[model samples]
Target: MGQEREQRPVGVRRRTLLLGAAAGAGALALGTDALATRAEAAPTFIRGADVSWLPQMEAQGYYWNNSSGVRQDLFTILKGYGVTAVSLRTWVNPSSDPANGHCGIEETARLAQRARDAGMQVLIGFHFGDTWNSVGVQNPPAAWTGMTYSRMLDAMYDYVYHSCNVIKYYGVTPAWVKIGNETNSGICRPIGGVGHPDQMTGLLNAAYDMSKQVFPNTPVLVHLAQPQNLTSIQNFLNAYGGNGGKWDITGLSSYAQGGNVPGVLANMQTIQSSYGKPVMQVEYGGPVGKATQVRNSLRAFTTGLQGFGGLGTFFWEPEGYPSFNGYNSSAWDETSRRPTAALDGFLNV
Candidate 1:
């Protein structure tokens, strides 16, 4: 199964522009090297999207042909909607899946390049497996199936280090990297499952450390599904901390239809109050045609999150139109190729 399997029910400095001329003059007076040494500030908020299906969609000859009869790339369309960042998932060997190589490292780098070109930051989410991983399953890559716990941890480190370098080689370094995707039950089955917090924390720690080595400034995230399941999240965090796990951010996945907005809000509040780390809704979706409901739900959800150390929110596959694979819903219109009103909801958020 792919990300679609999640249907199983579990889960700016604008003022700087005006100062540009003066800054440039000052830099020239001080020294050109002085300006080059200044570091860029990170964005205050993260308004993002997960468009991991772009490569697959294009491979199938699908273009963003809007109702206006104009052709535009998906990244361009997303940028127009006020999206400042993109989340992409990477698999060890996606070719093994029927999706035909989507989310593979090479494809992920390609999409990340496009996102950078569109002036959006990248968030590389590693599934740490060959295929989909969620609350229901966390299958190890075929090569890692029989590895010992210690070996698996080392392999995870090497994979994350090399993958980050690969994306960097493509002229884009992810602002954030998710050590694992929706890993509520833990990752790399048999050994790193939730039952084995020691091993799970070891794997997470290895990935986090290696990722930091590559992108020292990037924040590593540990993602979980079912934001409403506050108990499950607390349990995982307790086990993780008890086992000495360390991560910089908390990532979540929730759907309005599956979890109520109030529960989601409460969970976000609890996560921040208990863990003291920023949270981001890494994946969220609702009915395709009920734009108003989707918009209102997100409006309330995002608003609640803002007061509780929330980083931002991302809608999963809002561009999943002309449906491919077994996933279809909460997507932009096929004929218009424009974001549905539900997606347009982000504009105000």
Candidate 2:
């Protein structure tokens, strides 16, 4: 889901702009290019886009243009901008809501197949809910709502196994698999909340085990937003680690603004060094009007994280334009119906 999601707690709502005070400390210590030369020797760095909105957008009469004003497929446009991968999110028995629905396994599988056909690596994100799931909310799927804790573990395993098999049946084996989306407070709440770390870890381990069962070679990620908040992340990592939470990659959502990219990258590097897990910026973007700023930030993140031996950076719902879903952090231009310069940041990294 896009960052414009609703029903956030009072203090946890997504912040669009970086506070001046917040941008001064670590950023000054680690400039954007501090690690640029080191990143030159890193392995294949993925610059991806979350086109979960692509099918719906196309159905609603939306298309994209190349830099020369020539109409072309969205994938072609993204490729021209140096995108090497695509991330798709899936829900469990999703509703028919136009903007916020219909990412069920079948739909996601179709998208994965298309991404594979385009020669881009695929990263599958499982929300494990019937609708949007984020740090703000993580309601269990309708079918698993009243299940007992033990029963919920079974359901989680079954769901992951079934979903993975179904997706693979569509002829797309994802390069990376995200167990959940922005699962900071924990997944499925109440039962999976941090208050009951063991329960949450139980569910997470089930998902991780099932994911490995299907895609043994794929890296599984545990995601959280707001990488700059050291206290929050350290607490979650402690709770997760204390309870034996399993993950191959530590995925993050970086919406860093002002000059906080350095601090954010520092925090990510810290996570990697401390946890022995590679990191990736799984979600990021900014308003289309801030195209140049967003481009620079993206470049910094991609290059900086690459230097840190991180996996990748993906723009969340970059295909989303105004009126499509009430989201504004898109990489596409509204009036021109073409990609903004924000995506150009992915190049030459």
Q: Can you give the TM-score per candidate against the true fold? A: 0.84, 0.87
Cα lDDT tens digits for candidate 1, 159-210:
7766777787788888888988888888998899888999999888878766
Choose the strongest candidate by TM-score: 2
Best by lDDT: 2
Model 1 weakest 10-residue run by lDDT: 5-14
**In candidate 2, where is summed lDDT lowest over 10 consecutive residues?**
9-18
TM-score attained by model 2 = 0.87
Candidate 2: deviation at residue 291, Å?
Answer: 0.5
lDDT by residue (1-349, candidate 2, tens digit) is 2122222322221121124326643652242123322332457888899999899989999888887888998888888878889999999999888789999988999999999999889999999899989878888899998888987887887788778877778888998899889888888877888788899998997787667667866778889889888777777778998997877778899888659999999999999888767788999999889999999999999889888688789998888988889877888888888888888889888
